[model samples]
Target: MARPLSPKLSPSIIAQAALDAVDHDGEFTIQGIAKKLKVSPSSLYNHIDSKADVIELMRGQVMGRMDLSGVDSESADWAGSLRIIALHYRNAYALNPRLLPLVTAYSVRDATTIGMYNLMAQTLRTAGFDSTRQLEIITVIDNFVLGSALDAGAPDNVWAPGEAASPELRAALDAGLGAPDRAQKSFEFGLGLLLEGLAREAEVLG
Candidate 1:
């Protein structure tokens, strides 16, 4: 007779196994994870409350891989640090596209998530932004980074892959009226515009 599976696996080990399963299969399911770990489905419940909890754990694992320590809160170039953070986030998403959705929706109520955001907020505050303004800046930067990553990760020419553009769209393209160069040009443009607005606001407040 086949032996029953062990329930002795650590939560971290189970969580890592879950991520590996998702990475290898390009999909995830509780039963698949349990099978991968050689544990009973019920045994997984001893470690994680639910599938969402497992996903959240995986999300934190992904974030943990990022080098947040490199972001210097005392740097005079705080805006530059913010840019680096944005790029770091983009690179992280690029490396783990399978985890993008989970990371994007991960809640900040978790201490790790809140700590990450607070680090950014502290950097902004050190850069001379008041508490209220620091939060606003953080929110803007978060939206910008997440939106830029989503745009960059989208399939090129998604509406008609490998097909000629419609005459109207092609004509627009010829007139330099097509979608903006999304990868770098658009990111820099948005960043510059946001910084300009913030600078103007600072001047007005002073």
Candidate 2:
């Protein structure tokens, strides 16, 4: 008798299955992925050593798709470069915001994602940032991008004020309540704020 021709599993296959699981449930495990793929847990183990490996692959899958259309690693317009990168970075995670927490918890050893960081670091260093400041700037960008992803994941009308809420708070919510593309507008505004503030600090600390 001939054996059934099952789809062969590889690291990318495993990563894709795991990504689907995480996207649906906000978590995944080797067993969960195996069940999703209709494969044995042992089969998954054959391709990935641990959950961390699977998550790293998923990260690459997402980051690899970033639309870095205007990024210039050699451009002197570091600020413009930052804006372009931040937009792409936020958009990438917004696709699967559920995976953001997992991606942050794991160390980023993936070359594709590291490429973005390398550009940011190089841009800052070129602008006269010391190593320590470069790290801080990187952290700031990471935090903002992650928070932006979270914001994108949040349901529309994330804030609701009750009778006890202050008129000021209620009015503030009204201004933004049901606004079009609220998360996107906020992210763009916040990115500009961060970049401007960081540019000033870089000069001050230079």
Candidate 3:
């Protein structure tokens, strides 16, 4: 009998199955993925070493959506470049917010994702940041972007303080909460504040 044109199992296929499981269940197990793929658990083991490998694959799937090639770390507009990269990174993760917790729990080993970090580091270097500051800036950006990504998936009523809300807090939430583009606007506002702070640091610390 002739073999199938496409193999039944492959890394991408397994990874996708695992990703789907995570999307639906917020977590995945070897047996869950195997059943989802209608394959034996041993078959999955053949493709991936362990659940950690699957997590990394899922991280790649999400982070791979980021396009950093057009971003020029060597440009004089290093801050602008970093801003663009942050938007790309946040948008990519916004698609799979549920995957955030799992990925954060595991050490990142995805090459594509690491490549994005490498570009961010280069951008900071161009902005006159030293090695220590570079790592610090990167961590700040990582934490902020991840939090923003989760925010993008937040419910329309992000805060429901009800009667307990102080007049000031109530007024703020009433005006902004569930507003159109609330998440995007909030993220841009926050990113601007971060960039401004970084700019100030660059002047003194560069």
Candidate 4:
């Protein structure tokens, strides 16, 4: 006979369990998570519909940790608020590098994700941009942050953790072809540039 499942665990609990498995084990598998949580695999199914649900739950958990309230849309320094928001995202990703894959793959349909997008859109509106242009500006900023983080985190010749680099790669690295602080610097620079362009466009269009 099959053992009865515990009613003590809720969906949120199950989702959190799954997150713990990924955070500690660096992998997400049904059996692995069940074993870690001391629950029957079937029990988890009672809480979550699929592995996709688990991933979405974890992604929401990560995004929920971000503090978007600090971004004051009514403040005169709207550009600075945008910069702070970008820095918050960068710092969050830097702390949890594993979440980068999820951030890249996850869509913005979830409430937590939508909240993030809406916050950015609101900031843009506060800066005197309309909805359409706000979205474009948000997209531009997101892409810049994503690309910069990925580039900074990518393994370069000198910093490669795998087998030693080839001689030519090493020579190229020796030629001073990299910026270790490129991610932070580039993020600020890109935000400033984008905001400036947007301001110019607003003036021209007015």
User: Evaluated with lDDT, which candidate comes out highest?
Assistant: 3
Q: Model 4: per-residue lDDT, tens digit, 62-170?
A: 6667888777877767778788877776665554465556546756555786777777877777778888888888888778766665655555442652458788877
Consecutive 10-residue window with the lowest summed lDDT within model 1? 154-163
lDDT for every model? 0.71, 0.85, 0.88, 0.70
lDDT order of candidates, best first? 3, 2, 1, 4
Worst 10-residue lDDT window for candidate 4 reads 154-163
Tell me how many residue pairs clash in candidate 1. Answer: 0
Candidate 2: what lDDT?
A: 0.85
Off by more than 4 A, model 4: 1-27, 152-182
lDDT of 3 by residue, 4-120 (tens): 453488777877887888778899899987887777798788878988999998888888788787998899788899899999999998988889899999998989898998899
Show model 2 residue runs off by greater than 4 Å: 204-206
TM-score to true structure, per model: 0.72, 0.92, 0.93, 0.71
Candidate 1, 1-206: lDDT as tens digits: 98774657776677688778766776578888888778788888887887778877776666666687788887877777777777776666555566666655655544555667877887777677898888889889878876776667656553442357787876655654335554656777888788777766756654
Error of 1 at 68 (Å): 2.4
Ranking by TM-score: 3, 2, 1, 4
Q: How accurate is candidate 3 locally (lDDT)?
A: 0.88
Q: How good is model 3 by TM-score? A: 0.93
Residue 7 in candidate 3, Cα distance off native in Å:
7.0
RMSD list, candidates in order: 4.5, 1.7, 1.9, 4.9
How far residue 169's Cα lies from its native spot in candidate 1, in Å, is: 4.2
